[model samples]
Target: MKFTRKAQAKWKGSGKEGTGHLSTASNVLKETPYSFHTRFEDKQGTNPEELIGAAYAGCFAMQLSFLLNEDGFTANSLNVNADVTFEDGSITQIVLDLEGDVPNIDCEKFQQIARKAKEVCPISKLLNTNIQLKISLNN
Candidate 1:
């Protein structure tokens, strides 16, 4: 199976003063405000690294939910927070914080399943950056 998304960006002027527009083939559009002061700030709109973190977190959570269900333990809720760090124009780390409420599953089992899900999730497999995982279980 294969999937693809097409996006384009157009920038004007130098990195500090340049601003850019991003648009997907599906016509979703966004803007990037570049300035010397905000080398790390989100001046406006979404950036690539932020998007990657969002995608990875969402995907991993869903996969973990499915794994829980498959193990006969339905989750009450699953919340995932992903942090992506960039340095030297490359991704340095991706940290995943996962919190879940499972009615009948023990902590050990839940942790085991979560670890397996993290290992097998599509986004985890795709990323080359160091992935750190933290899991919390609630009764």
Candidate 2:
């Protein structure tokens, strides 16, 4: 099976002074405001890095769940936090911190599955930078 998703961004004015709005096909982010202040400063708005982080976190959690279920295990909760590091005009690294509560699973098995998921998740494969995973499993 194959699928594609679409999102659009419109920017106006100069790089530092300009503002932009992002919209997705799903309408979840319709005309969402983003600007230099939002990306570089502490202003209240959305940015590319945060969006990437959110996507990675969501993707990894779902991938992990699927892998766990394949092994006859189910997760009670899987909390993932992705921190995307942008430096020197490039995305340097992404760190995924996962706190999972699964039943009838050992730490070693959980760690192995999580590592595999991190490697195979779509977003993880799309990124061409260093990726790190930190897992805290409660079984």
Candidate 3:
């Protein structure tokens, strides 16, 4: 919303047999390789689903951190893992698992805030598929 980020991807040859490269403005992924084998065969390379998972996890964590700060709580650490489900040439669902170390926060409250963060995260809002959140709180 506030920042304009950019990423470029180029593919050559056929869909299943071809290869592609992806690059981001930050250069974190500079011409990274992706192909059918990498995406669907569990080969060693980067893929779109994994990249989306990373972005969603990071966005949700930051949003949750901000929400905690607003409630006068500070998080020592927040670990989030996003699982993207791709089936039948479509992404059906995404699951975000969060484990947080925040001092003096109840599980119920943390769960509530985490759910809210999932609703409001930029990536979550941008996505059109089903999204679910699972939370584990440590005080």
Candidate 4:
């Protein structure tokens, strides 16, 4: 199975004064706005790190769901939050906070599955930074 995703960016001006527009292959981003202030000053626009965090969170949650089904547990619901740490112009770390409700599963077992998923997730394996996971499971 092979697939490709794409996004493009265009910038005008320079540095913190410049503004950019981002668009994806599917137009989901449709000329989204971004700027130095958005990334560094927490302004009202999307940033690269925030986008990466969103992708990671979504991928990890889906991986967890696959693992839960493989273990014969019916996942009632799953939620994951990714915290991407950007420092000194570099990505320092990523933390995945997951909460799930699954039937016929113990906390210990759920943790084991979560840890395994974290290691196996494509995005997690692709990122080399310090990665951590916090999981809460409910029966």
Instruction: State the lDDT of candidate 2 residue by residue for 1-139, as single tens digits.
Output: 9998999999999999999999999999999999999999969899999999999999999999999999999999999999899999999999999999998998999999999999899999999999999999977
lDDT of 3 by residue, 1-139 (tens): 4878899999999999999999989999999999999999999899999999999999999999999999999999999999999999999999999999999999999999998999889898999999999899877
- TM-scores for the candidates: 0.83, 0.98, 0.97, 0.95
Position 81, candidate 1: lDDT: 96
Best by TM-score: 2
Order candidates by lDDT, high to low.
Answer: 2, 3, 4, 1
RMSD in Å for all candidates: 2.4, 0.6, 0.9, 1.0
- Model 4 pairs in collision: none
Clashes of each: 0, 0, 0, 0
Model 1, which residues run further than 4 Å from truth? 25-39
Stretches of candidate 2 off by over 4 Å are: none
Model 1, 1-139: lDDT tens digits are: 9999887777777877666666778774545433433346756566677778988999999999999989898888999999999899889999999999999889899999999999999999999989999999988
Error of 1 at 81 (Å): 0.4
Best by lDDT: 2
- Model 4 over residues 20-84: C-alpha lDDT tens digits? 99999999999999999999999998999999899899888888889888989878988888889
CA lDDT of each candidate?
0.84, 0.96, 0.95, 0.91
